[model samples]
Target chain A: MRWVDLVKVEARIAPLKAARPGDGRGSQSARVSVTETGGQLSRSSTGGVARLVAGGVWTIATADRLEPSIDEAVNTLRGTVEIDLGSIVQIDTAGAWLITRLERELSARGVSVSLVSASENARRLLEALAPAERDVPPPPETIGVVQELLEAVGRTMVRSWEDLKSGLGILGGVVRGLSIGLRHPRRMRFTSIIFHMEQTGLRAVPIIALMSFLIGAIIAQQSAYQLAYFGADIFVVDLVGILVLRELGVLLTAIMVAGRSGSAFTAEIGSMKMREEIDALSVIGLDPLHVLILPRLIALILVLPLLTFIADVCALAGGGMMSWAYLGLPPDTFITRLRDAVALNTLFVGLIKAPFMALIIGIVAAAEGLRVAGSAESLGTHTTSSVVKSIFMVIVVDGIFAMYFAAVRY
Target chain B: MRGAGKNPEEVIRGRGITVGFGDRLILDNLDIDVYRGEILGVVGASGTGKSVLLRTILGLQPMRAGEVEVLGVPYSDAAPAARSAVDRRLGVLFQHGALFSSLTVLQNVQVPMREHLRLSPRLMDELARLKIELVGLAPDAADKMPSELSGGMIKRAGLARALALDPDIVFLDEPTSGLDPIGAADFDALIETLRDTLGLTVFMVTHDLDSLYTACDRIAVLGDRRVLIEGTMGDMMAFNHPWVQQYFRGTRARRLGA
Candidate 1:
């Protein structure tokens, strides 16, 4: 059956080739044919006169194949040229532009060009396109790889400077908004803050708890496996407790919140900016920082520490379960070890980083959002940057906290 | 509805085109035919489904009953290659100028040409520039993004893209809605000139009475989920329907004398 289909396909294609005899591969002078009514061009020179006959459906579809022939005619044809348009069945702007271009190029070369026997429709199009025969400006030049790289580096530096300025501006605006809310407690948008809190915090509990629990179990199993070699299997509980309380709990929770709530903040505010709603708010004498960013920022700052506490507890529970199941240490023994290993300060250090992380996330997201231009693409770009910049800042702030605690010997 | 005599070739034929969103019927059993080489202006009161009918004929919206034949092909039911062949021969300019926001006007015009034809980049540039100039946009406006263009310039840029392929038919949705009077008049003149020079069949959904009076060869008024009247300006004036009477003989339309 396959062999029969192949034979039939060949039988179909054989006549197409025969019917289109002008079809040739990469011939500069050869006249190419497309469809049955595709554009056809032929050149003949006799006694210092070149007579070119153009025929068939001369539109944009055939312009690609017809263009090279016209160029070849322009470059090679010398002296007077007569272009016969009698046989041309149809001509659109593209075709007319080609003929007009050929005429202009020949005239520029001191060769008298005459368009003869053009049909009424063809004549109208040619006359219409006569004024449109101006030189097209060349496309923008592409720079070399080295120059592009250097330019990108320079752009990144400038962009970073702008980001810093905008970040500080947002922080100041947030402070001003907070002061306004403090002075007029009635102006505080408590409903909006609660809405954002519900959206970003309450809805996020299950996913955040599940993620932290899995991390805690994995860490316990790995640590117990390593500690057992030295007959120090009981030390895994101390490791899990201190790590979850001081670093992993807050860091993982902040990163997750940045991915979740931070991107949402950027997208929401960015779409408002894109639609000129931000400008509308400003014109209405309402500071967008107060009306829009304040509620979201307050909610994030209030929620991050609470979420971190939840994450810590879930992680500790996961570690206790893992120890009991894998290392044969019971939950009470694990709890006793955790209490002995980690102090109140250890938990405080982690909880203290949460608000600062929240502030960074909120500021970056809001700043990026407000920077969105009048395009959906710009909104997407800013939303993505908001997530990336907040995550990077979260890690950097965590590292700084770690260094500060180490330096003070806290 | 068929014409009285002298049968003209129908470039677009919509038969019993029933379109609705959920249970709300916008166009019910509507039939419309647009002849070749004619500017057919479709007008109606707001929410009468003028744009819906246009979308139906273009196959952008699904019709619950009947079919549309464009350029003698029922493209919705046609094979993929056949559909694209018909699609290449048709051009559409949406109400909002619908230029790709990320691309410049020049690149937007080149998009259709690039997809269908295998022209050289230089030829594409020149053709695109010619189109831009033909639509009366400033040469420098070619490099500006859609966001940077004014409302009138965006419409012109969109028209340039629509005419990019030298399509057999051009469908324009509210082409002059956002333009100033002078710009709207210029656009109407441009559309008329394009039709004359390129022999293009234009299906224009417009509210501009000036365009209907001066540029459109025939007008189709949509009403009550179907076409109420489809005829010349003279026939429109004589039609006794209340909406038709108000539309053609309204105060705004009365400024242009019969």
Candidate 2:
């Protein structure tokens, strides 16, 4: 009846187990035969004393598997429960925890549970983990939905305001850098400007040309279908030529450049910011605006008009070819009608908008890039916002130019 | 884990594990075993294939030879079902805090549970929140993406996801590397508490000497294309191996009270 003596009994059984040549596992004899190695709880009654026997590896490895069974057994127990660990060869913190949880459960049922013949290691591990387990703090509370929405709105407003300020700062710095370079022309980085030109301009040529060509062909074809009913089919050449030379040519090219070069600039600047490369450049006494942004902006400004011209020529050729195919007019006849309908000043007006639009796209992209924070998510958000903002700015600039030319009758 | 069968002392056993890329042999005929319910720290100089060894045991990297057994099952030879079942019982913590940048902290912790269990959304939410709190993260962190969390917070959130499944073995890769001294000590203590409370067997790859002395129950050194030595801290200090001697008795080691 002295359950405290079970540890002594286990110690005593060790030599006896050794005496039996095949008893290497030592004193594994079970009272109720719970055979599972993961864990098993069995009921036993010795001389009217109700008891529970725990056997097998009662550790975290077996926690998920053994937890339900432990719960079930704890539920079935009544009154005072004496838990025997004499058969438990291995027990971990989870196993010890389960035993403790069972004890608590039993106590709740008005039944006191006592552990018997537990290993010293299990006792120590349980003791180490027990004190801290009760202090597992509750999760932090979330604010109300209304507060969260307000907070989000406030954060976005603050971020956008900061973005706007940074954009102005960068634009002012670019202007100052441009003025400084203008005064000291020999000191300016011509090679860097040319490289950026190749990147933002020269390289954009083929795609722009092909895209413009397709647009012109589509416009001429679509115009021919409607105009044939009015017997103004030959005027398809005039419409395609004027639209391509004046508005569609530069507007489409600017949009494409905004998509391509603007995004690339943002990503490049954003990554540089993320890596602290921009900071490193400053530490070395280099002005990033003068060294980096100026070249890109200038190159974009220089090449956009050239790209627009290329788009206009390709589009006119496409319109001429489509006029011959769809309106049954010869190529020479289409060319002659195009020349008569479009004026030189219209071409000049569209070309005049290109540099300003390019400037907007480059400045917005570079500014967003410079604004990028340390996270990959920040880089991505800035890149997307950069393209969107610049494309918007480009269209606005084009609209202003259109108004300026219309009011002047130029 | 590729090594087969569990010895009385072994929970993770790797025998003659040979890993190489192209012609360069990284770990050649390596033999090591992680005892059950102990924090076994695997230490080596950088580029010594310590991570590679851990990867090989987890079956992330291919082994040219040798086998490993984890939780008493052969990892490589087991059927996909059996392997994944074993995988469910294990978790890995990366050193660089590679939490998915897009997902909220709660969603990250729920990833494994959602994949393996068809628990209801409310239940999953409760369980995921419990895990985040268990790792000592703020509850508000559950709604925040990985990008929003600070460096230490990211690691703790990553730990929450690793412990979501209540795994038996959690492999920690330099858990305390980037943390400040106090933060590192707190992290080490957390690892110990989880081990004691959960009965987890930890296999950690680390260069932190404080972790080696305070957290790890046993230390295994990887060098010369295999496990150079495996023993307690005392054994490491007493060993005659040149690199081990320099590592354990170095100036940095002295600062760690080694």
Candidate 3:
């Protein structure tokens, strides 16, 4: 009984020896004559015997149609049988399936099947039947170009609709607030008056003072040199005063406040909104509009006008310094000329534009701020928008005021 | 919890509460009544409307269809002054505590008292310190900012702030979330003690098992679009509902020491 335990086999199977036809070796068969009593087997040929005893021989040949001979040989093995699977050079699934069934049936019958030698293809075929072996399924298909395009289009449409809806909702709230303000005139008017004082008159001081001081220094430097050339240096006092009172004073103050306070209002309210504090207020039975917006609006309005007045004084002082250096005009002489160059109407025109610009800044910044949602990311976006919108609106309002003042003068 | 001896009916009653977000129904015709000095826990998976329920009742979120009566005050029908008067009767510990980052712990705790009552600075400071002490934080912790405290410490500070007003009804959202097990257990003990000592009607939303077992007088299991079952721990343990059974059973599939 030539028994082999291929089930626990670990060693790599050596290659097969192919016998050429008509080389005194049988064409149809290669036989090993075993001396059963000695428990040793030898090949028929002298060369085959030497190689068999020296290196253990195996065969390789195709099974063209020898099913009967193969079945008969496998059945005659009563104890155990080892096949030189290296001989199986060509075998279809038909042959492979037969081998598998035979292995299972013979093992159950206490007849073990072993591989003395196995070809690469035969081992692969046999291993495929092992329980854990499986084919790796192909990857998921790529999304088609048309499908990708359609999905992108769908997402864009959804986003656009969401943006439009949010815009409409905010616009509706603004319109409602305005309508109520109109219907309740006395309340709105009083609020407007107070806010004008705070936002426009009062809060615009520091920036106005700083800017006017810088402007005056620049004007003094430029005029002093120019006046030296003309030898009419003293007239620059009138020049500085006229420019300060007529234009730069109010315009500079308005632009400064628009950037400073406007961005501040937006970021503050926007952050409050992002934290759901606004909603928290409403939930507690407090009107968020009255509590948050009204006070801020009033503060800006009340401050702007006062700031414009301060800005005028500072700009003139700056101009006076320039005049004193260039035109040999003292601070007293500069003030006297300033008093003569522009009258009450110039101050009134500048102050009038201050409140309008203040209103534009307040409304635009507060509106943009209240629109903030989500996290800190949205906070940055709303703050930027608030500053930009406030500045733009302030400039536009200033243009309208300029137009009206121009028309009146004409 | 001073009203510990009072009957359960006198606690908090919510009638026909229905809230919606635009067209999506968040809560529909929901009614919850928490007994005096009882810890009522609201439990559910994420997005099952647990937080919404807490908000609507706390008056931090609006009620589209129902009335919330806290203590004896009819909060829904109350005027602004009356509503504020009602708000004065309750305290809220938000999920994130929502402590003012600008104010110190003591100032945060003293806010409601300063706004609604006139107390001497000394008295206010004493009260704030007392509340902080009750929450097991150092008296010196009162001067620190909310950002300076750990997660558990922030929650304790928030609890102190909530307890400042000596509110009868306290609403806490996920009080033990983000805390370690031991810290969470300590928080549970603190909550249980607060319920006992203050005689507060506690309405809490949480997913913590220890809190449900140790603190809650009764548990409401919110699932399948509604509260499928609500009962004491003993009753909940015996609940035959598939979700409840599976939840209590947990994953017993793995063999130990295999």
Candidate 4:
């Protein structure tokens, strides 16, 4: 046996040893030799007739050792071969499958194989496994590496096209729902909107506030250290003020919300789709976009800006505290510097991106959820991609806004 | 009910089983026995602990108080080796066809063989294919994941995995619950054929009256927290209990001319 086989034997015996520590039969070396000697096959050839004698346990546990000899016998033996099973003490499906496969292989090679002195139980097992002789189709072939790469690239391109179409479709449906709701305010699901606001906005306050605060303080300390080299440590207040209000606050908040509420939306709607609840609603003449997707979208759009405003305030407060402690800049001086560095448009630039980010997250999540098939695994996959696609789109939209602001010199 | 004494032919013997959740007792001092080479059907009303009994016997559920001996070994309290020895001889098919979602039907059937025995992958594949065919699944189903299968195919694949080890006793929970009438009958016939060829002792929990009539050799009715009656289909018809009377001779049973 190879080293790997020895390791496998040790792993197999370890559990048996732990299970029965003091039992005499549980001796590891003793059991290995016993298994080897339990099953025996001897072939004697006279002229063109080969008599193959088999004995002892022929179950699955001993099949690994017995299979090679059987294969060799099938390859070398020609003419008529008689397999004697008279001394076989035990057998199972695995053992029977082996014997049946051997007989079939020999017969296919035009060697007449006959079974003699077999017990009734062995015959029954062999008959039960005889249907396995029917040809089974081979597993699907895999493409070569270059072709596989091309296939993947094509699949991803088609998938992204489908995604873009669905995103536009959902946006149009939401717009239609908004128009109908505007015409008849009473038709809007205000209670559902409120419930979702509490779930996605109100419950997320503490974590979002804490995250913004930590990020603000880290930026303050790092900038102060760099500015202290030039004896301009007070400029850390301006860096913290502009960066937090213009970019980090809303971007971080959108990323967090994408991970949190965006994935939740996909999971909830995907499970409903999996169970055919969406179909049930359609059959009942209720639009899923109007009832399900509309409330979530509106709640996200309304709450994201409010959350962004709160995140900005918390981040500014954290920067103020960090400037005071780390740079010895008093709170009053830090406030004056922040006021001088940022104007009204600075905060609005960040808040303006909030609703657009929310829209992207909602549309992607709802689209993925609606695409779910009837499996828990599919629901999980869609939920994962909802978060991933929304986060990626959020960053991409932020980059577009950045480039637009820089070009127009805002 | 039959006496609770041990019998040599009994493959599974449970005595004085008591199982419960919280303050509610589900099974109270229940005694059950499964004989070798017999298709024993266990039936009861919904939430009457029929599945709970099956789980308890399989050692998946913890019984409040009981002792179960499988293959003449005390399964519940045996040494780990002895318990695993008993476990290797038993197979269980859960309701909902709980094949591992990530594995193909072939790999699902190979799981037990991989864990317990040292066999080549080629032989394992052939044996798994044999089992899949034995359970009446199409040959091509070997490569399909559990998600790709329909309701009936899932049950058949689950049965194939259960029979992977060539177990002596097979436990089935609601084996034919979701299939159409023709599909359910086909599954029942498949179970009967497997039991005949493999000499498998089937312990099936079912609600399908046709299956109980056509496939089972003996029927056990669980009611009032214990087996109310156990015998042939004729014995179930002659039993005096109201629930048993309505169940075996109900409108659906009447459609089958019971």
lDDT of 1 by residue, B1-258 (tens): 122125566767888889999999999998899876788999999999999998888888988998888877885577776677678778899999989888899999999888876789988999999999889998999999998989999999999999898877899999999889998999999998887777777899999999998889899999999999998999999999999999889888887774
Please state what fraction of the native interface contacts candidate 3 reproduces: 0.00
Model 3 global lDDT (CA atoms, 0 to 1): 0.64
Which runs of model 1 end up more than 4 angstroms from their true locations? A1-36, B1-5
* TM-score (all chains, Cα) for each model: 0.92, 0.74, 0.42, 0.91
Greater DockQ among 1 and 4 belongs to: 1
Per residue, candidate 2 scores C-alpha lDDT tens digits across A1-410 of: 11111122112122221111011111232112111244567787887668888775564434555567677877787877898987766565446667877777788788877889876656665565444333333657889999999999999999889877877888899899888989999868899999999998989999999999999999999999999999988889888977888899999999999999999999998898877798999999999888889898999999999999999999988887888887778987777777788888878888988998988888899989988876688889989999899888888887887788789988
Q: Is candidate 3 or candidate 4 better by DockQ?
A: 4
Q: Comparing to the true complex, what docking class would candidate 3 get?
A: incorrect
Q: What share of the true interface contacts does each candidate keep?
A: 0.33, 0.09, 0.00, 0.22
In the range A255-330, model 3's lDDT, one tens digit per residue, is 7887887888788888888778999999999766655666566566657777878887887777776666656678
Report how far off residue A88 is in candidate 3 (Å). Answer: 99
The lowest-lDDT stretch of 10 consecutive residues in candidate 1 chain A is A18-27
**Model 3 chain B poorest ten-residue lDDT run:** B249-258
What DockQ would you assign to candidate 3?
Answer: 0.01
Report the C-alpha lDDT of model 3 over B73-179, residue by residue, as the tens digit: 67667667656655755789998888887688989998977776545554456556666877888766888887678889999999988877666578899999999
Compute DockQ for each candidate against the true complex.
0.36, 0.18, 0.01, 0.29
The numbered model that scores best in TM-score is 1
Ordering by DockQ = 1, 4, 2, 3
Which ranges of candidate 2 are over 4 A from the true structure?
Answer: A1-163, A184-195, A275-292, A370-375, B1-9, B15-25, B28-31, B62-69, B72-80, B102-107, B118-150, B232-242, B249-251, B254-258
lDDT tens readout by residue for model 4, A125-213: 77777657556567679789999999999999999999999999999999999999999999999999999999999999999999998
Return whichever of 1 and 4 wins on lDDT: 1
> What is the Å distance of residue B233 in model 3 from its true position?
2.2
**TM-score result, candidate 3:** 0.42
